[model samples]
Each structure stands twice: as structure tokens, then as C-alpha cells.
Target: MREFDSYPTPEARERELADLVAKASATIPGTELIEYGRSVEHRPLHVVRVPSPAAGAVPRVLVCANTHGPEFIGNRVCVGMLAKLIEDPPPPLRRLHERAELWLAPCLNPDGYARTHALDGVGSLARLRHNHRGVDLNRNWPLPAGARRLPLPGAGSSTPGDATYRGPAPLSEPETAALDQLLTSQKFHASANLHSFMGTLFPPRVRTRADSLAYARLCEALRQAQPHTRYLRIASRVFDTFTGEQEDHQHHTHGCWSVCVECFSFRASLAQSFARRVPLFWRFNPRDPRPWVDNDVPAVAAFLLAALDLPPPVSPRASRTDP
Candidate 1:
């Protein structure tokens, strides 16, 4: 068995991620690193693009992780997926690469990620979830036209210090604005926002029956493609409230088949709960990340491939019904 330490420190993580991108680009044909935007702290935000082997305009897929600071396992899984794609892609990933252009953003919230590692498990978990200016990047996305924020639990908060604060306005933060620009320009056919510890796949809140069914089928593909343990597919129901989440924004505004992939497992969380003093970070990420990485990488590939197989959305600016 391989012995592993806790998650990497901020500086080490940045250096390692850059090195991984550089290596991938150097070894793999058509793989390039793009610096799309910078975070509030001036940390460069990058996406590693792996162009499809096929000719002409093909579908595009985006896999981004670590929007929240403490969920470091998502970053690991994204890196592992990229490595698998370049080194030895399985059937689904190979098919995906052959059919579509893939972009991997390993760490979306670098500022928040750095802050969490800097704390060294010393601060509140809520504080670790926000960016440098204390804004929740995941909840900072623009809502669909005419869709209002319903009064519901876990939707988001207006309070500055709260965990799910949605910032002053949509696209207010540099990180989210950068991602929005990327999504606008790329218009990906499918996207997966990697999160941790929930052990479920959450599809965006759909307004139409057709859209809901499409998401259900896409999530089922993700569930069936897992070689190891499978996660629950949590499809959004009609009455579900709209949170200013990235998946929702991607699906509604960009017409992308998007899902919030809650990696890790409730079983892992249960095990961590037995510890006398488990830090918030350990609760979200396992000690050895290999198992989860091995499990999720292929599932994500299958999900993206399945999305490409589905029919395209009605329109890029299609309006979704308000709750």
C-alpha cells in the first residue's frame, strides 16, 4: 500500500500543478496551458486544454474542480483525470478525447485554496469556503433570466461572513468572471464542477421536462460507468429552488449539460467522524486520495462522453422557468 500525507501546501500545490501542465503539454500533442484570468490575489488561473484528435469543429467539455478551498480531493481527481487522458486513457476517456475538446481547470479558486492551506487546519470551515475577499465563488454565478432566488434552505446567503455568501452581485469576483468568460467563449457541450464529500451527482435545476430527462440520463451514464462504488444520482425536481450554483448557471445560461460531482463518500465521512478531532479539511478529503481519484476520473469521463452523445440544447440563451 502507498503511504500518503495530508493535502499539499499552497506553494507546493501551485508549483506541482504548473509542472503537471508543463509536462502534459510537452509530452502530449495538442495539449496547451492557457492562462485565462487572474484571481483577486493576482494568482494566475489556468486551464489545460487537450484538443480532440478528430478534425473540424467538435464538441467541447469542461472539467473544473476546487471551487471551494478545503475540497482538495477534487483537484487531485482533476489532475488524475488529465494524467489518465495523456498517459493511458481508458475506453470512455479515449472515446471522449477522440470526440471532443477537453479542458481541465484543476484549481478554480486558487486564492481560497491558498488561504485554507495557509490556515493549516486552524480556522473555521466556513471561512475556508470563500475566496480572498470572502466571496463564495460557487454561488457567485449569474442566475438565469427571470429566475429569482427562492427562499429555501442552502440556497445562498446575503451575509458577508456566511459560508454561502453570493457576493455583491453576479460576476462580481474575478475568479467567477474569468470562468464566465471562458464558458461564454467555449460554450461547452458539457461541464462537471467537482466538489467533495457528498457522494452524489447533482444535476442542475431544470425547467423543462425534456431538460430534466436529459440530465437524468447523463447522470445515469455516470453512475453506470463507475468501476468501483457508484454514487447516487440526485436529479433536480420541479419544486427544487435555484441556488446561484455553477452547475445551474452552466446548464441554464450556457446550454451545457452540467452537474455538480460531489466526490468522496459518506462512508469516508463516517469514518472520519470517528476521529477524536477531525479537521474540516480531513472531513472533505481522505488521507490517501488514490482510491477516490481512481473511482471518479473514469466516471467523469463517461459523463462527459454521454453528454456529447445527447442532443444539443434548444438554444444557448434559452430561458428556464422560475420556481
Candidate 2:
């Protein structure tokens, strides 16, 4: 319904995604729509479920996007994959849907997402990174070892105004708490939190050899998803120890094999004509997310699908027993 290869505004995207999920639930055999919780601004947090009809215990894999609002490309990626599953799933993807329970939450931060669209001129770029309360949701999770507070020196900022502010406490914001509650309630074998404008794929900081091997296989699978698009692993020296990050928190608390996927660009670069035409905030996402959706949805979906075959995370007691 939208213009060919054009992106939707936040409001339009939300309605379309909800409609797509509703259609999938009505038409697709095993699809269902799930409302997990509400965002701080009271927007519904949605998860589109692609459940397996087969009898035995099927592993669950979650694909979530828009954790950081301005990075909206992943939202379309989720929609495209969900549509593919409903319409004409490829052989491998069909197999994935058959073998695993797939859950997709396309837009996790609606307030920030809307803020990106609501602002005029440079305001969008300036306010795109934080929620309405000015907290960076991605940087607001509890640290490893069940620590609630991130050390002030390395926690980005104690004040709420900064882009990377870790918030007054871990999971202080409603968006992060809703996500955390989802993890606590359901056991996901693996999860991928999608972001954009950094063109990197960062696997969680894994502890065991089994987890490492599983993570490596996932990395390779994602790389193979896009023929020319290179997916880089986040380096250990810097990104491995970011306090209160979602990937770190997911793995630390639930033993879920999680990854942070940054797509679209390695760095922010703009086409000469397009940059002059649109606001700076639009540049954070791909100029046209539709093309990226066609190229990367399968790859993103494949990463979640591939988790079904990977080694499950080590049990907490076993992990504790190891060195």
C-alpha cells in the first residue's frame, strides 16, 4: 500500500505491522499475535508468534527490532520475514518455522520511534537516541552477576539526558522491563536484537566452548544470508564488557544465546542528493528500508531459525561449576 521502496512513518509502520500480524494470525495455520506489555508512553508492545504445529518440545527463538528507535530498518526486516512465513516460505525457512517456535517483536520502543518521526528539522536526530524520559533503553539492563547498578565511571552517564545514559537503575525504563519480563516468562533458545547504521553483528559474550561454537555457527549463517553484505563480529577488547547492555543481560540472566545485530552501514554516510533532501534523523536508517528488507530479512530470519539446531545454553548450575 505504501509507495514503492519508500519507508513508512512511525504511525503508519505500526498500523501496517499490526495489520500484517493480524492477517497472519487469521490466515496462517499456526500464527498468533501476542501483546507482551506496554511501553512508557503506553503504546502496545507486540510479538508475532509463528508457532510450530508439531508435537514435541520445540525451541523458541525471538527476533526483536527497534530497541533503539532510530534504527528502524530491522522493523521492516521482521515484517518481511513474517510475511514470507505467511505467504511463500522458502524451503529452508519453511523448515525453520516447522522445527522451531519463532517470535518477532518488530518495534520495541514506540515512544522513541514516534519521537524520530514527530520531530521537525534537527530535533529528530538530537532526540532519536533516547526514550521520552531521556533514558537509553539498550544501556539500561542489569549487569552480569545479578548486579543492579552499573559502576558510575563506565556506565556512560548517571544523568538521564545523555544518549548512552544507563538510567537511574537497571531495567528502570518500562521498555527494558517489558523485554526482561518476556525473557523471564518464556525460555528462548536464542534471540537476536536488531539495530542499524553500524553494519556489524555482535554475538553475546559467551562463557563456554559450546556457546562459542554455537555463536560462531550463527555468525557464519548470518554472513551467508546476504551475498555481498559482510557481517563483522564485535571485538572483545571494547564491546565485550559494556555494562547493562541487553545482550549481556540476556545471556547473563537466562543463559539465552543472544546477539546484537547492527545493519545498513558501518558508519553514517549519505548520498549527496538524498542528504540534502531529508532530515538528519532519516539518515540513521537506510534511505529506503524496503531494499534492505529484501536483502537482509532472510539473513536475519535465518539467524533466529538456525538457533534451533545450536547447542542450548548450559544450565546455570553447570555454568557455575565450570571455570
Output the number of the TM-score-best candidate.
Answer: 1
Clashes of 1: 0
TM-scores of the candidates are 0.94, 0.86
Query: Per-residue CA lDDT of candidate 1, range 1-323, in tens?
Result: 01225567767777777777777777667787889999999998989898887999998999999999889899999988888876787788889988999999999999888887767644786789899989888878877777889767678777798888888888889999999899999989999999998899999888888888888888888888888879998775767777789998888788888999999998877787665576677778888788888888989999999998787676457434333
Error of 2 at 165 (Å): 0.6
Model 1 scores a C-alpha lDDT of: 0.84
Give me the displacement of residue 209 in model 1, in angstroms: 1.2
The Cα RMSD of model 2 versus the native structure comes to 4.2
Instruction: Give the per-residue Cα lDDT of candidate 2 at 13.
Output: 80
In Å, residue 291's CA in model 1 sits off its true spot by: 0.6
lDDT of 2 by residue, 120-206 (tens): 324643277787788888778766652334345545566666667767777778888888889888878888888876678888665
Q: Candidates' lDDT values, in order?
A: 0.84, 0.72
